[model samples]
Target: MGQGETEKIAGELIRQAVMLLMDRNEDITLSSVLNILADFQMRAFNTGQLNACIQAIADVSAAKSGSLREESALKDKVAGKCSSCRSSDNVTTLH
Candidate 1:
């Protein structure tokens, strides 16, 4: 395939992967998401192409780190709180 074809395929794969993650409400971890993208790339293109696609995805998603951190913190806070405890003094925050 030509460079244009390779890039097209890679873009489609990345799009599908992103949509899957969004549908599942999955955390956008680069390593984990790259694994999925790499699998598709390996089948659709060369290893080099796979690496390039992953890099592109990482670049686009890098700004989302702060949002992910906030979401994780909220989840942790919810999980750590006890429903039976009403007073802050009776509840201990887990670090």
Candidate 2:
């Protein structure tokens, strides 16, 4: 894929991950980011694409987690749903 296409894919993956967190009323934290990244790693993404996707996720995750409160509470919430969490399948690819 071209650079633009890779960027688009990364953006979509980030959106899907964010939507999943939002739908579950969860804040985006480091654990959330790791969970989302784990889901993506289960797919057949190329190295460059995966790197881009990870970077995109990290960027958005940092922004979202900026106002995190009560580290212990966040940890509990993250641990609760992380075991069965999966990234959304709302991906869009160039044909």
TM-score of each: 0.41, 0.46
Estimate candidate 1's RMSD in Å: 8.9
lDDT of 1 by residue, 1-95 (tens): 56666567556766777777888899756655666776665665566676657555664456357668767776756676544566545666754
Best by TM-score: 2
Q: What is the C-alpha lDDT of each candidate?
A: 0.64, 0.64
Candidate 2: pairs in clash: none
**lDDT: worst 10-residue window of model 1:** 55-64
Question: Candidate 1: which stretches are off by over 4 Å?
Answer: 41-95
Scanning candidate 2 in windows of ten residues, the lowest lDDT window is 86-95
Candidate 2, lDDT over the whole model: 0.64
